[model samples]
Target: MSVDRVRTAAAARGLEIEIRESPRASSLEEAAALRGITPADIVKTLVVKGRGDQYLFALIPGDRSISWPKLRALLGVNRLRLPEPELALEATGYERGTITPLGSTRDWPVYADERMTGRRVSMGAGAHGWTLFVDADALIASYDATVADISDPIETIR
Candidate 1:
């Protein structure tokens, strides 16, 4: 049903996409390998909590982690945090690891990492055991996402 929602949303936006069945993987690298793409080609949708009842989606590459400081500056907010999995599910109608902007119950604003531009990227398909592929540029344009350097290499964060 979630996939159906995603499909409907994509159609409404005239955004072309491909959905594929995929096995669960233990890590980002494994997920990318399963999808036949590099880790950077896989985008992670993160639900960030802002002020009361406010949330936004952050699209970061699998090889990077959200840069909280950069994001805060971009959002012009001093505070932002990731809500618990349940809250995220309630916000986006998709479980963690399967969250995508498409078909979200609410149309939260999207912030995408600049590195994803002009490339094909794999992302969650609003359900487990599935992956959605789309043109990053089109996705950004479709959502009118704010594209910026909002992420840092995962190693730097670690």
Candidate 2:
């Protein structure tokens, strides 16, 4: 049902999206391998808990980590934490391995890092082994996501 909803939404917007199935990717490196794309192209979705137990989703580049202080400032909250896997699944209708910003049970306020602009990115598809690819700009526009600098610099190993 979640997958179908996402497909329907994409179709309504005339987005030519591709859903690919593969062995479950537990990390960005594995996801990149499964999708045949570089790590930079995979968009990682994180469920964060803000003040008053409110939850929001942040879409960030696979190669980066969320800057909690920056995100908290943007959200106007003092602190934030990653939700437990069970809570995350309950809120998004997707397990830890399959949470995407699209088609969540709630219309979550989405925050995308500035690095995602003008790129082709891949995200989870409501199930393990399935992934959805779309234009980063289109995704933000369709979801009414706010663009911000929410990532901490990650050094790449040579």
Candidate 3:
């Protein structure tokens, strides 16, 4: 199972995490309420396509979304788009909402929005209805992710 792979990876890295079941939540808002955290604390994992079939894993706060301009500038790429769902699953070994960098099939490059630091965030656990509650800094460091300002609040953007 994907969640088991995630747990194995965490153990190999000496990181401890708790996987919370969230089968009843129908939306991000509801999930946050169930997790007892503010909506902004949920982290969304996005799979973005770059030039020549390259892909990147972007971590954005649930209340915000990617800023293409900033991401392109940071990546020095001219074109980037969210891949079709099937392609994402093929690349990450986890379905859309359950994708996480922790146990991806490939250790694709990771980037995190600067805002997530020091927050206790809920992110997908590689399974439906499950989320991993983790310390942002610990997660980022464990994954060796590049942290940068690459997103804007959803309302502020579009």
Candidate 4:
């Protein structure tokens, strides 16, 4: 049902996408291998909290991490924080790892890193074992996303 919701959302936008399913793996590297892509190609959809209970989806490449300063400056706000897992599910109707802007409970603003553009990116498909292969340009245009340099290389990444 989750993946179906994603398909429906994409269809409504007239954007073409390919859904790929793989066995649930133990780590990002394992998941990438199962999907026949490098970890960097895997886009991580994050549910972030802004002021006054507001939320936004932050799309970052799997190998990079969100830069709080960069994101805050781009968002023109003083504070931005990530929601807890439970709150994230409530905000997006999907678990942390399966969250996507495509079929979210609310069509909140989407902020994607500039690096994601002009590439064949793999993103979450509303299910842990499923992923969506999409053209970065089409996906961004379909969502009217705000593309900017909101991420920086992780130093001692967690």
Model 3 C-alpha lDDT per residue in residues 127-156, reported as the tens digit of each score: 997999889899899889999999987874
lDDT for each of the candidates? 0.95, 0.84, 0.90, 0.89
For each candidate in turn, the TM-score is 0.97, 0.89, 0.94, 0.93
lDDT by residue (1-158, candidate 1, tens digit) is: 89889989999999999999989999888988989999999999999999999999999998999999999999899999999999999999999989999999999999999999999999999999889999999999999999999999887434
Candidate 3 residues lying further than 4 Å off, grouped into runs, are: 156-158
Candidate that beats the other on TM-score, 2 or 3, i.e. the better one: 3
| Residue pairs of candidate 1 with colliding backbone atoms | none
Residues 91-137 of candidate 2 have per-residue lDDT tens digits of 78888867887778877789999999999998878877688999999
Local distance difference test, candidate 4: 0.89
Off by over 4 Å in 2: 12-14, 25-27, 155-158
Which candidate would rank higher by TM-score, 1 or 2? Answer: 1
Weakest 10 consecutive residues, lDDT, candidate 4?
149-158
User: Is 3 or 4 the stronger prediction by TM-score?
Assistant: 3
* Number of the top-ranking candidate, with lDDT as the measure: 1
lDDT of 4 by residue, 63-111 (tens): 7899999999988999999989999999989998788888888999999
lDDT of 1: 0.95
> Which residue pairs of candidate 3 clash?
none
